[model samples]
Target chain A: MIDYDALLNTASTMGLRMLESGAEAYRVEDSLQRLCRAYGADSCEIFAIPSLLIVSLCDPEGHSHTRVRRLYRRGTNLWQVDQLNSLCRAVCQGTPPFPEVDGSLARLAEAKGYSPLLQLAGFAFVAAFFTLLFKGTAADALCSLVAGAVIFFAKYPMERHRANSFFVNGACSFLAALTAIAGVRLGVGQNLDKIIIGAFMGLVPGVAITNFMRDVLEGDLFAGITKLTESLLTATALALGAGIALSLLGGAA
Target chain B: MMEIFTGLLLPCFYAVMACVAFCLVLNHHGKLMVVSSLGGGVGWAACLLCAFTGSDIVQYFAGAVAVAAYAEVMARLMKAPATGFLVVGILPFVPGGGIYYTMEYCLSGDTELFLTTGIHTFGVAGAVAVGILLVSSITRLLREGRAPKNRHLGGEK
Candidate 1:
């Protein structure tokens, strides 16, 4: 017989995964409720935000099991979110055994991210294309491609060390801005604004802003406010990074 | 020289490339990446069309609504969370440029440009929020309206 604690753990695990994978708070709550109901729990309650998730389950006997997880890191991984979405759908359809759901959740968490080389290439293309989209000349795109590669390489080490988001974003943007400025100074690119805007694409917190709006629209007011503040912080870090470099460049010239 | 063809096509191509790349960065892969690219392309095309009118806020609001509406429909058809597409679709006009320019002006001590850019940046950001909220409310209403019908149809069994 599967222990009640084990089943609650499984349900809460699913909720935690959804939360960490950037699902909205209400979605996480709904998934937890469904998973618990499918598995025979009388009641389930979940409070999920970007930073922390609280889940509790109650049996008919009035005994309850609760779990709290602190999400020290939060970022989008649509692949994980997609898989969890499928898992919850399955759970809602049938009460899969705890072990099966556990295996799936583990697999989802262990899913591989894009390779570093591919990520670098992706960053380069994103920066270059953003320059083109901004109406920069081909020369500007070429310059941004190189700067993007540098920023990607710099970002890898910081992320590897699990650095803070603000510091990582600030440093990455500074490196990108400085690289673009240096290139323009060398006559390799024209217009610092285009270059700065181009390389700034990746660090812009697009996902945060998008998720923030979605959360608010979904009536997850606390989650919305928290994510909005977080987005603002990220934008500030990005700007500070680029601004510092531009001012330094100005001073030196 | 209007160069209408290049002007029309370049942003779409760039939007597609940037969307795919940003998806990779966000760890979104598989066929949905292509869907995201298409969504991004169309949303960007809409924004670019509005941009010709020289109204930044309008384009952003319209672009965001277009993107969110697309994401909502696609999510229903694909049985996927709207986020997987919404996050990438509006990449072309997410105010990254405005934020950068605002900061640059601030740091360089250009008070006039800084204020203008800063206000414009916040305005565009609000426009995006407004657009998404508008579409999301509609989708929510649609879903809630359908729930009763599904229950009446005895699908709950």
Candidate 2:
């Protein structure tokens, strides 16, 4: 018999890990998989709400890809006996441990999914784009890009989760953008064209744009809108950076 | 001439490294990295090939196709989602900078140049999309047709 309390706690830990990892959408699914295994429950499927509540409430301005799937076990699979109802009972009530269960459960948890790092990379790319547009100088744009890249690279050494890593990434972006602008104004030739081009070098809308169109084609208006909104916000941030920097300079002059 | 090559090389390298890093971070196996890199390389190579040949349309379509193929193959082998690989792998080939510049033109109040650049950007995006769709649809059709054979070969009950 599985200790229900212990199982839930473990599941919650897995959930926290996923959230910290910037898992976008697959976090809940992966967590549920772990929880089901721990409880010796047969098959379980996790349905993540399409609304950004899961990710945004935790870390606003963070981007996550969302996914939904159905999981089931075939014949002779240790956990296949209990379906959704039984699994719910196990989670809510104490279910006896099934000693016959395989060791795959622990293996699943240890499987590294660099969820948070990916999100940080995406954020840094967007920040770099914005810095270039706003600074309107090649040196400033390059500095911002380098700064963002360095912050992202630092994630390898820090070993922190997504939220903290992104906070660092955002700080680096702001600093890089500010520094670049200051440096350019000091004497460097302000090359607007190169700055704009370099900033956008990292902020390609490949995933969002493709997914938005795919969702629309698949007749998923809700999903499409969600993706579209996320993409627009990132783009707006890029535009805002450039617009603000230019306006500030104009005002000063 | 060398300036253009240098310009193209940096972006291509960045695109390939980003795709590989994404795969590695996802904890996908070494096989996935190899396949994705190969695909990305092929796509970028197509771009350079196009530049040499001076055929923009062919270059764009070929690059998109190569990437789509790479993504499909990797997804099937890794049993993971293909979206991330496809999106990041083909990013270098996209005309995002062109679109940004077009918008900039309009923002700076150069409407005529903005219109021209905007149209050109859209044209590039449309061509790329078509190439992607073509490759994806073909791969899907082939997979569907071979599903029974695959199942049989795998000895599925």
Candidate 3:
């Protein structure tokens, strides 16, 4: 006999994982429904927004089970999304047993991303190259590189403590602008605007904006609005932080 | 020649590097990193190639279409979700600079420039979104046409 309870648990867990990793709302809803149906669910209904997921399904015996997951933390971990996508595809195709599905999900969750040092390097390269793209001089790129490193190191701990995203972005951009201004003051960089813009790219809501469009296009109006708000708030935070820094230290430079 | 190199080639090269860096930040691993970063290059190149249109909004739109189409094809080949490619590829076209300038104008008390820049920023963002919408909609239609059985159900109203 199919274990409907275990099936519900696994399906909901997968959905939660995908949502946390920033899968588009439609993808999350579609995946959950597909998984439940693959396991012989007679009917499945999934409601997903950026901040919550509700999944309900009925077994052949007419018993209904529902799982509600309140999501407080959302991040763009595309690797996790890709891993879960493949796992979902495999399970649906092979009709995998419950134990196997549970184990795979556990393993995938524990998978590590790049190490801290590498992530730091990633931050630096992103800042530096974007400066060049914006027509900053070589010295400005170097300054933005240092500013990016500062932003990463400064923001990492607050993020670890689960600080409010807006405050974190604001504080990071404040630091970025401060660094850029100091770089100009010290004669290490030219073009203050270019340096700050490069540093800001690290904090920009590019992923949020991209996902926002996709979500809206997929007809997930609620999720789309949530993402749009997130992107807007993030941009505001960055600007506020940078604006304060520029006003304070900008005069000295 | 200098214009071609600086205006066209250099930005695309920077786009590739920046995207690879972004892949690392987002924890995208394996050969997918390089493949997806190439999409960023394709996007910026498309943007530059369309420069004759004399409108930044149109440039962003062209770039988004190229990136979306590339992401779709690559997702099929790699058996991975297209989100990774789409997110990273479109980064070059995102209005990070526009946002900065808009905020800058607001902070500096240039309401006139602020309004214009902010509206232009929104226009650019809308163009990118519509371009993505257009391509993905067509791809979905073609996919459903080929495989009616695979059409998604139960989610839409």
- Give the best candidate by TM-score: 3
Candidate 3 has which clashing residue pairs, if any?
none
Error of 3 at B111 (Å): 1.1
Residue pairs clashing in model 1 are none
lDDT by residue for model 3 over A87-129, one digit each (tens)?
9988988987899999999999998988989888888888999
Q: What is candidate 1's lDDT per residue for A69-95, written digit by digit as tens?
A: 888877778888888998888877887
**Residue A218 of candidate 2: its Cα lDDT?**
35
- Determine which window of 10 residues in candidate 1 chain B has minimal summed lDDT: B148-157
TM-score, cand. 1 vs. native: 0.94
Instruction: Give lDDT tens digits, candidate 3, residues B1-157.
Output: 9998989889999999999998888999988899999999999999989989999999999999999999999999999988899999998778878888887888789999999999998899889989898888888877765532433532564
Q: Count the backbone clashes (under 3 Å) in each candidate.
A: 0, 9, 0
In model 3, how well does chain A match by TM-score?
Answer: 0.97
**What's the TM-score, to 2 decimals, of chain B in model 1?**
0.87
State residue B70's C-alpha deviation in candidate 3, in Å: 0.8
Off by over 4 Å in 3: A251-253, B1-3, B146-156
- Name the runs in model 1 displaced over 4 angstroms: A1-3, A251-253, B146-157
- CAPRI classification of candidate 1: medium
lDDT of 1 at A76: 77
Q: Over the stretch B10-107, how does candidate 2's per-residue lDDT look in tens digits?
A: 54655565455444433434555556655666687676667766767677778887787778787677654455456656665566556556656666
TM-score of 2: 0.56
